[model samples]
Target: MKFKRYASSFLLQIALAFFILSCGNSAEKKAAEESNTETTSVETKQKTILFFGNSLTAGYGIDQDDSFAGLTQARIDSLGMDYKVINGGLSGETTAGGLSRLDWFLEDEPSIFVLELGGNDGLRGIQLSETKSNLLAIIDKVRAKYPNTKIILAGMQIPPNMGQEYTEEFKAIYPDVAKEKNVTLIPFLLEGVAGMPELNLPDGIHPTEAGHKIVLETIWPYIQAKL
Candidate 1:
């Protein structure tokens, strides 16, 4: 009888150990499933936006925190939308530079693209046709990769110092590109903010924090409808 009792006790301990192990495994599997569900939910909720531009878009000479892209993201979040705005702004980047990086930027498959280039090209007096060609390539590439992605072209102005003929050509580039590509255009990104001294940065080129606000207001209507 003593031997039988000892044997029974040993079997009971083994059974208890097996039960604990099974519970742990089950719990782990359930947790993993929950984690995967959460990930999927977050992904579905978020939309990806790629911002490709020059100094203005890069928030040149401004704190990274106060850059236009940062402000736009903050506004997006405040509106309670799930979206990711990727900054691909390269300071001093011309149209050619923007085109060169197009392939790499498209790898992430952005749902929307904000093209704010050509300013540097204008500043440097790059050939108009060359600038247009580079922009065309980028537009084509984006359309091919993500056909549904919304494209917003931010237009720029040439300093009167660059000959009136050159200035007119530069000014025309934005609209022509937009029209040819059939994409939305933000004609004169600076709009009300550009010439306003109070809204501009110390450099007299980049926009101040207040300038960024004005920008948002300018672009908000069109962007809102798309969003």
Candidate 2:
């Protein structure tokens, strides 16, 4: 009888240990699952701010981080805003090129879409009508894919190297598109930064680091209000 009792006691201890280990594993698994869920939720909460433009938006002469779009991202992060900025700018990109490749970026719906093309078209002396048509088509595509995406057209202007007639017409393209589409229009993207030698690189086409900072300020008001 004593032997039987000792053996039974030993078996009971073994069962107890197994039970404790099973509970510990279950608890750890539950905690890990909860953590993963929380992380996914945070990621989904962030809305996207798409900056679709050309070399000016690409930060041609300076570190991309110094671009206006980059600054906007930094500001959003610092404020803990639930928004992310996607820089879709391509160097030497014209409105036609932008429209062709827009579908790629539209895969993910953006909360705000800042259109900043046409400067290249103006510089190249592309017909103003063609430039305007391309801009409209691009906006239409965005609207079709994501109707709720807030569109903000960044107005652009080129030097009289294209002639005063072309220059003025180019400048009017943005507002015209914005008005027709009934979207937000940034009066002048490079308002304070343009024509300032210190703000631009030797090319005078792209803004320098300081210039991008100024550009950031110009658009912050519009972005802040949307956010």
lDDT of 1 at 112: 78
lDDT accuracy of residue 134 in candidate 1: 88
lDDT of 1 by residue, 140-224 (tens): 9899888999998888897877899999998999899999999999888889887788999877899988888788788777677
Report each candidate's C-alpha RMSD, comma-separated, in the order given.
Answer: 3.7, 3.8
TM-score of each: 0.81, 0.82
Return the lDDT, model 2, position 72: 98
Runs in model 2 deviating more than 4 A are: 1-43
Tens digits of per-residue lDDT for model 2 on 1-227?
99999999999999999999999999999999999999999787879999999999999978888999999999999998878889999999999999999999998899999999998898889988999999999999999989999989999878899678878878888888889999999999999888888889998778999999999999999999888
Task: Provide the global lDDT of candidate 1 against the true structure.
Answer: 0.86
